[model samples]
Target: MVGDEGRLVGGRYRLVALIGQGGMGRVWRGVDETLNRQVAVKEVLLPDGLPPGDRAQLVRRTLREAEVAAKLGHPGIITVHDVVRDADVPWIVMEYVSGPSLAGLVAQEGRLPWRRVAAIGAQMADALAHAHAAGVVHRDLKPDNVLVQDRRTIITDFGIARVLDGSAGTRLTRTGAVVGTPQFMPPEQIEGGDAAASGDLWSLGATLYAAVEGNVPFDAPSLMPLFHAILAKPLPPPRHAGELGPLLEELLAKDPGKRPTAAALAVRLTALHHPPTLRDPQPPAPPRQIHQRSTVTAPAQPPNAVHPPTRPAASARRRPSTSAAPGGPSRRTLLLAGATVAIGATGGWWAWKSDTKDDAIRAGTSLPGHTKNVYALAYSPNGKSLASASEDNTVRLWNVTAPDGDAEPAELTGLFWALAFSPDGRTLAGGGADGTIHLWNAADRRLVGTLKGHKEQVSSLAFSPDGKTLASGGLDASLRLWSPADRKLLARLDGHDSNVAAVAFGPDGKTLASGSWDNSVRLWSVAGRKSVARFSHANYVSSVAFGPDGGTLASGCWDNSVNLWSVTGREKTATLDGHTSVVRAVAFSPDGRTLASAAEDETVRLWDPVEQNGIAVLSDHSGALCSLAFSPDGKTLASADKAVRLWDLDRQLPAP
Candidate 1:
């Protein structure tokens, strides 16, 4: 029996409409008037097999699900809005996602194309990457747990997952509850070994195989046979997986160690070409080899005819003649003396060929700029001067030549973490750990004024393209929009539960993006003073930058990956993975041809943003690289570590 609509759930959430029913619970689409938002309310129906006391345990388990889901905040991960009890029934309020499940897609489309499959796989991988970074493991992963809208994918049903290092009381399974989907479970998972990130990878492979092949790799008419096949038989390669190439082999590897990491797989999948075919056939052997004897022999030719000389004979004939007097002219010497005759016979063939020097330059180099670990960097609209913010607490202005040459850098002081130049390169904004935003004349290294309002450390700062509004995020968990001219705070946007780490203005300046340690990135309307979208990540989002086209937003996270989201916030176009540690900063090259990421791994990586492949790694830094900036001319890149280093974009290799 279900409760009436007037009944209040969890003392807060108001039940509205029944949305779905599952084996373990009933779900309702409810409204959280307190938050002024819609949330999915799931009510667990206690199993009849459980005793009165055991029923309490079941309720406790349901509560734990909410606790676990709440910790995993990621765009690709379904958000858990709230958790509470309604009339003694445990309920969880999650972000309401109006999207079709992956199971529905399979039923409707039969099979998805490789590109879509790859795209989905990449998203899932990124979700897992964030979860793993936060020490969480999604024990159960399957098609039904994945949601798709506008062809964008998000992983849901984190009910059975557990946060790594989280308290044991939060674990839901009752010792032998059969936690994962049978078809998708990895061998180690079935054996009850602690599921690691690799288990999720294995499941991703199974899910991807089913999506592209229209059938599970291990399948049968009945459960027993399917179980046997999954445990015994090898998975069949996807028939329609044309140019998936190395990705196919990597995804299906039996040994988890042999499989590519999520970051590596994302890069490989990005290069996949559809409608691929098998390798080319071997060419036929020459006819002369078919008639040859077992023993090898040189072919014979007439003396007057042009013939290829045998190596041994030519060397022997060219050796100094012992028969000739010491230092006297031999047959070879006589041939050299008659070089003019030989040259005439050869028709001057050798004179036409000449060796040429290689002219192509490498990609990714540190450009001249700041003097310390750069915390912020951005290219001006016209892509001329590059501005950098550093731990040295100074903003540096750099002059870059159009083609490529020497770079001259000018410095200003303060331990700044973020820097942005006006669209017209007339003004510069620098934010620091001291909770102040300073404006500067871009043309000269003079301070214009300091804008102050934040009560804590300022982590990020951004300026509207119109240069009228500036947005800043800080440890106060608030976003402030400022009037640069009057140094007045226009609006204080507050919602995040933790420190706000990043902020950016959309191309039109109508929207602003702010990322925080709360593991959420919120999209706000500059005029309406309202949030338009909320994106979650499993870990703190460290940085966000809009692409040159303004159609996409790229976010870097402590998860060590970057995600590209469409403007509508309906889809994640790609997940770029390469950093081995927390990604502290991310920026696009002036032309958007390359994406530069600085990481705690002490390495700055340059990636092909569109292709999602890492093009180069700048490994000279011995400390964490906190920020990166590209010159307006697109020829130089400035990275910050203990000391700022300038990288020549045209130089691909590392410094000696």
Candidate 2:
């Protein structure tokens, strides 16, 4: 249309030329008058042949969800500058890449060389790792989403699959609104699972399978047959996968649980692309320094990767043995923390310390069930039950009383980032991406009511000690108080400039402390709904929790470190660092004697909060660690990914 060319969108963006158009959306190379920069604008055009219903709302929300991609900062990933809706059409502003899409490149060049495929796959893995660590699942991972800018590979259009699926699993199959490409969709996805990050790894494998073999692992002329082939049929062996074949096969496993997690995929890809020739066990950081921050630079792997191997089994250089893990699970090198922080752990306790020491926690057993990433874990007040929430949009209610007993899956309307139990254990609260708090009857797991107020996904939730008032913080940067009794909003507390990632009620329930992406934790007076004080974090804070005594508060951050603050002093008492990845969840043991922390490193560390020294590192998970909770008796520490792990603290021994 003549009106489209040279048209202004969101006031300042002038669409100069159409770069491309597809079933998903249209890409336009445009100019930003305000920023004085050239930009690529993606006008998300809903595909044709859909049920005749209003999808405009879906577009807007999906665009907002894409904002979560802005948090993905890896160089291999395209930068999402802004997402806006103009005239009911959503436009995403991103860094303009001059290179062709992987799909375009592969189409024009037929089949890629094994080395080329390895190189591209490695970069793609790195990008995916970053997304996974940030808790953003690139629901759609395919050749078209990969952009090759010279030697650099970048992934784009994140949050699309998540936003597209909109509804809970399997229903997409009924509505024919499935999230990803047919050939690239994982079995879990075809069957109607929500945005499971493991499914992305599967898609990555298929994308690589197509890049080298010149065809996807599975295909059919129609959608039903294609899904059937994906489900019942096995992945055809690759003809040109070269050394990458084994990894590809692993990624395409029929079982999602059997796949390499977000962190492992990147490490495996990098290890294959750059095979270690040195006799040394440690693979010298790849010739390029870019692959160091993520687990072996895999891009900060997933939160529940069966094991974030920390290093390529064949890579060069050995990090100092976290004295605790000399013969145990591998731990990456520790980064120096900001200030007043220490790293490592020893006898018993959970805390991320920076120093390399003999103290470390031992590995624990995995409780299996969920097929996707677990984002939040919470123990019921009475401690008999545990709740784990995942992107799969289901919360697994584990019977902690038996610890080995079967779990009951509680269906959710949407994905929740945080879970909290009522003080009396009569109700369970789920904070979800849809920005609603779903309350369920504790015993039967039946939905009782939905509390709404936050503008974006609820990132964290907390119930007062008295169980009268509930506090919530979200990506909308809004902190809200609600009375579950009446399902009404009591007040909205506003101060944070970015996503409020965590909320916690003080021991007395008189104060609420919230952590945010703005790099600060604000303490508010619960009843007054007024900001009482502010504590600065070394980096974007992901979690905040109060000690049993309420005299101290712990804040976990993206900086791969944890800071404990003295509640009275409102100042940092100690900084602990040990994990190589972002610290996602921090919890206090029932007695508050042991402070536990989980990070992207896939290890849960115990810290002696009183001594401010390292206790022990618990290594058992695969991808990044998101949430941690302690059983009422403090004998068990719970963390989630695909399976919820219950660390038997009493049986746990210091690493050799």
Best TM-score among the predictions, by candidate number: 2
For residues 1-656, could you state the per-residue lDDT of candidate 1 as single tens digits? 25656456767787888877765567788888788788888776654455666567667766876687689877788888777876676777788889888878999989888877887887777677556545567766878788898746888767544421122432324343434467887766555466677777788888888888887777677656766776677778679866553466566666767665554344235323121212236355333221111110111111312212212211111111011234542221112211111111111111111113221211222344344445666666676566666655556665443333234455577666677776667888887655778888877767889988865557788889788888988765678999888889899997875567788898789988888877778888889999888876767788888877877778887666667677774456666554556677888876787677887766676655555544445555556667777766666566666555555454332221
1-656: candidate 2 lDDT, tens digit per residue? 43699999999899999988766688999999899999999988665454435465576567777788877766778898888889877888998999999999989999898878888987787577557656788877889999998879998888876776653223354345454578888888777666587889899889989999998889888878888988998778898888788888999998988886644455345435532212225445433121112221101122324213232122222222122434443333443331121233232322222223322221244567777778888888787778888866677887755524457665554667788999999999998765789999989888999998865578789999999999998766688999999999999998986668899999898999999877899999987889989987656788998999999999887666777787887677776656666788899987887788887666777766776656665554556567788888877678875667765555332343
TM-score of each: 0.44, 0.53
lDDT of 2: 0.73
Which 10 residues in a row give candidate 1 its minimum summed lDDT?
345-354
Residue 604 local lDDT, model 1: 71
Off by over 4 Å in 2: 1-365, 409-414, 651-656
